[model samples]
Target: MTRPIFAATPVNTPVHGLSAFGDLKYPAGFKQFDYANPDAPKGGIIRLQPGDWLFNQNTNTFNTLNTFVRTGSAPPRMELCFDSLMSGSLDEPDTIYGLVAETVTISEDRNSFTFRLRPEARFHDGSRITAEDVAFSYDLLKRDGHPTFQLILAEMAAAEALSDGEFRLTFSGQQSERTILAASTFPILSKKELATKKFDSGHLQPFLGSGPYRVGRFSAGRFIEYERVEDDWARNLPFRNGLYLFDIIRIDSFSDRNAAFEAFKKGETEWRGEFTASVWATEYDFPAVLDGRVIKREFPEDQRPSFYCKAINQRRERFRDLRVRQAIARCFDFEWINRNIFYGLYRRNQSPFESSPYKAEGLPGPEELAILEPLRGKIPEEAFGEAVVQPTTDGTGNDRRNLREAARLMHEAGWTLKDGFLHNEKGERFTVEYLVNDETFLRISPGFIRNLRSIGIDATIRQVDPSQYQLRLIDFEFDMIDVAFSLGATPTRDTLMQFFHSSTANLPGSNNYVGMADEAVDQLVDIAARADNRQDFTIAMKCLDRVLRARLDWIPNWGSANRRVAFWDKFGFREPKPDYGFPVEALWWYDEEKAKAIGK
Candidate 1:
């Protein structure tokens, strides 16, 4: 349930979590993860800010308590309520140890897996977790779970419960290592609860789970809090030991960031990961920060690489032409924007997998050409040259050379300047509104809007609430949207299918928001899927990056390799944070002396 902090970057790195093939970095009897302190004492009340930080909407609204269903937006960190069969180590890049399941054994052909549930694993009501419950949970998910679950389980044949303590999940020959990993990661629900309550409906009643925390008290759209269970099962499990220390975790609901910032300054919220760079650099002069009660830190990102790009809805006829899309990309002045708006904290990102080994650089090599040659006419010829690079403008906020090139591209796309508006022969003015959920874009939007206007394009910005935005996005009801996605250098087939395959291109709730449907993408993704080793996967990934750069439509944007985080000083964490992100919940513990000194 760890989602992206940004649009596409995963909150948890793949290597840090339960891996698909049980190829774990830790052995069977490993005590604890290197990132986790087995001896750390656990006691504290941690208050966190929820809702979408990318859009700055502090409404903190969550309508449905059932997080797995598609009815409404679920609260943040809803995944914490459920326990997966396995858990990942923060120190490793791609590995998983047993959690609910004590031991896992896979078939030699890699088509079947048998898991033995831990004897101590129990549900919230103290009923022992059994193989029947696992089978029932799989049945429920296949029948009425999220679309993602359906896609992930497409290759899974069945989850057969043989006894009270053991179950076997068999898959088709097309099953992937990533599929096995996903089959193990679902939140196991109580079969007894499913027998009494409806699983498909949106309700305020929390679903019964077996995790360390449970939903205690909540007021719709205002606030919700999770209380830790003292008798919670699996606390001593090697994978879960010394985690979830906070007795009470309260998610503060706010109307705006100003109110949230004031509450954090006053210690109403425990800590926040600073998203806005300017705010991190200039806005820490408050009394708490000046007095050293709070700390600001930057952690380098070591997981998948991601980039923010303005996604042009190609389903619309206006963007069907490649020249039009390229013209739009030419309009964005990344150099000027990074210098002034983003406070020079970001770098321009041109490839889908920016700054990673998978990123396509220079001309195609022999391995890449082997993949691209088959689809010569199917892909753009420009892809044969150097990878598509965005126009670089001197930081004067306006560059005449790029503007002239953009003008030519626009003209070639049959858009002529008419009384300050780009009009076609049919008399429709070319216009697009940037759809957003948060008003934070209003500050940096003027610059992009001004540049679009320079090319006689009628561009505007539209902001909506969080819930409405989610609905519209699911239905693909926007003209253009700026979205970021995480793609690693050697991503697994599970991720490649969701991100690039044509099979999920039109799925309503799938991540194919750009509606990309290209044969080359489908082929490249298949190559990545069927690859048997890392070298093969790397070749497929590089080929994917090259084709995606020329074929996919998006206005290139910026990226940040470091995570800007700010937190209170009372919490103690071990040295050597993971290369990907901060492991706050698992490793950070309450410091009695620091809290006393800070007077918390």
Candidate 2:
């Protein structure tokens, strides 16, 4: 019973007048915007510029921000907020479909779970949501949250609050239904408001929340308000009944994104899309999208489990050679970065479950080699017997058979080529480096480091600063880096054992920063975290995606067909689901005189 492999495909329908800024003019019936406008007004002030703020509050420290009491630029002090007991499919991924836990109940010996807590939930000081505030916010996020928040409550083992609304928890091994849907990042706080507010981080207040907004005013690096609670006991759940609907919700913080898209094109901001693509194909064509006051949409989401590749550093001993990591994964060209820097709108991801449904592609058939022939020969028999190929750049420009199969796998890994460079057998030379952080990898790693110095392999690209690029990625001190690993919307196996586990190597900012261990990827991530159904979690996630595409530990990039927003047509929105984003608290307020008599 192992058929799975489905590769996805089917998309192609955007050719009647194009325009994601490239052949404009095609508007007619995209009008639907009265985001609750009692005469178009509610309370103004919306500035936001977030590209990183929240300098430190020790959200109970996880992997960085070493000890802090206060360092804010505001926003990150919500008293309690989490509700969604089931609403998915706007594409699905910002998981948690069950709001204030109204039903969880797992235990068919998958090791306990329970939940059941919606007795008219409360807490904005109206106090109610019990189960001992969800077992005291899981024993204070397993003692000061974020170390992957106790790897999603590491086999929990006893959380019991069986009364006051019943909770349970229990797990010592095998429970993970993505750890009970990551108990929606557990935020139920207020065990008597942190025992009378001495909860440090410069004790900012606002400790009471049954969510749907409440805080109502803060001013740390300027601006923080939030109000709309209107008696919100998990407001009829289902992806939050009509969500926050702003009765006032400000955030305002800017570091820059072209001065917050010029304060969202001078309206001071009431939502702005993630611009840049030269302000989404040339700054909002003023007169607000030809006089509608601004509305530039581009939905088509489902691809963001981010991975724009080029990582390597396999404990960097010249990338610990699997033929120089399959010749640097066949020297990147990703169809020339999807037709010149992602305008052709990306694709190509090859595994670590790209676009999910447990990606496996080809080879391993025979019921996936009967669950990968019990890790026969312990993994790489061309990853369970071949078929993962795909590197063909024939755009006529040249990737010449992936640069002659990356110079015949770096001259059969002993690396020789000489005068043309490659070296090794102690002549040394091989080189590599490549660490970048932008200017599009200083323009695609200098044409892929001039095709790895035309096959004699030298590579280079450095560029730092993002705190010296998080101190050379927490001192694994580079040899290849180009990050991006977002994934989490049931892309489990504990998110591929927290990124290629070797016990999350040197845990620092741990997402197993590429130190990849493998006992057949730790027994197919422990049989896809105790499978038990969904056809044994698609046969242990297609045998951990055929041993992570035969351990080429990352060389998969591109995916993000579109999210590209640009708000302000007054607000109101819809079409967006997958890793959800602009629900901007259920927008509302776009009846500009009935959208100027329907020319919106």
Candidate 3:
């Protein structure tokens, strides 16, 4: 006899997936995501140096195993060991399908959501995953997880277990309608394992998980390996099919990018996502690329807007004036940096919402005007005019016109050049420090610093270790920093709040790197969150984008249109990666035949 998968059927009709503003791509009972290769072979190891990371993860090094908290550096891919109620799709913008959950029932008012857990879900310790575990996970993350989690879970009124198989989450009315999309994807911790442990501790202890992989061999700061669970309960699930196929996925940490690239060259690591443009153009001529052992390729980036920029800390009194911030932004010469330093491979970034439909362009439309009309005199006056665009330079390292404008702005802000330094009315020198973990900035930052110094401002670059850099960022102790973020195609309210909300401005470990605490931006975020339809949401977001660009809180940098990657030739991956993400760790698999042919 076949065992039942669910307890009692939900009282309301259950859905297999949730969408923010569109129909579900896969209906109930769908076999697998279209991008997944269900028939792909699953074995062998894939070693990589992760170029991107999320939350508390540091790509260079780690000290703690608990990535859910904000105290210490956590290794990349720590989330692979934990299972969530729902998992997202790479092909869709803002949608999720059940993973640990078999189905979900939405209340009529939509503030409440009930999830029916699959009876087969089990933790690594062979303990049954009950609804109580899910409730515990949410409560723990809300109470003591990273500040990012605390900010996102602020709208969740409560999480409760109705039965062994049923978990319900109720949200406060202040929450956006689409907040559930993010809430459902949080990693569900095993209450039995983490309940007794310090949830806020930065120790390197292993936490119980119910996902397809578990932490295997790990050295504190050098490398961590995840061994695939041979008897994973969700191996055959529709949402999990053909994913997490590697038997062993290993991540190695290096103190710098060049060191990681050298390791990649020595075959210590098999894959690397190239971040340095000059290195991509000049390097890779090593033996691996000379033959065909290594393949250099560019993959399409997801549809989300690429947010790469330098954030000026508004919390500093020296940077409080709008004119001061605008003057500082004018010092960065993107055209010269792109041509000389980056090998002309990057495009100048203009808006934080770059490459997306919400990027404000030309003048505000009538709908956007309708959203901005009420906020007149409250927001920047430039918001109603043509959208703010970065000034164009002549591609020379020194652009006289832009520098002249910058000097005028500085003078208006009461910063005058005296004794070879820009000093404000308070007799304090205008000093700015660019803090970075990677030494690559040592080469790229000199030109920008020269421009800042040319305008009589004292600007310097400081490179610290990755751990120290992360700690400084967490404590909001930097004058300026270079960073990038991958945003969702359909951004949720919580996502925007983590980056630009007033509530998170002073919250430790929050993503509000610019320390933005604008009342107008907060109201605009609320408008965007309340938008029920896609068209209305787009208008509100565009309105917000216009205002944010004019504020110059973040000095937009440069970004590439494609993902530059180099990997060994022994692996096989499906063509045409997903539109929303390309999780090579989960989607690509080892090919024994190809490995033999390539002599790997």
Q: Candidate 3: which stretches are off by over 4 Å? A: 1-11
Stretches > 4 Å off in candidate 1 = 1-23, 50-59, 487-490
For candidate 1, lDDT tens digit of each residue in 1-600?
Answer: 322111121222222234432345675577766666778877887777642321112245777777776557666666777898776555554455678887777665557777878888988888898998998888788777776677777787889888998888888878655566556878899888889888863677888888988998888877788888788887776666767777777786665566777788889887776766677778888988889999988767656556678888877889888898887777788888788877888888887787566777899889888888998998899778898888789877777788788889999999999999899999999998889876667777777787888998999989887788778777778989988666532466666766566777777766676778877778778776666555666777778877778865766677787767777788887776775445465567788889999998
lDDT of 2 by residue, 280-358 (tens): 6656776756776666777655553445465677776777777787787677777775666545655677666665566
Model 2 / residue 496 / CA error / Å: 11
Q: Per-residue error at 213 for model 1, in Å?
A: 1.4
Clashes of 2: 19
Candidate 3 global TM-score? 0.97
The lDDT values for all models are 0.74, 0.57, 0.87
**RMSD of model 1, in Å?**
5.4
Candidates 2 and 3 compared by TM-score, better number: 3
Task: Tell me which of candidates 1 and 3 scores higher on lDDT.
Answer: 3
Each candidate's number of clashing pairs is: 3, 19, 0
> TM-score for every candidate vs. truth?
0.92, 0.32, 0.97
For model 2, the local distance difference test gives 0.57
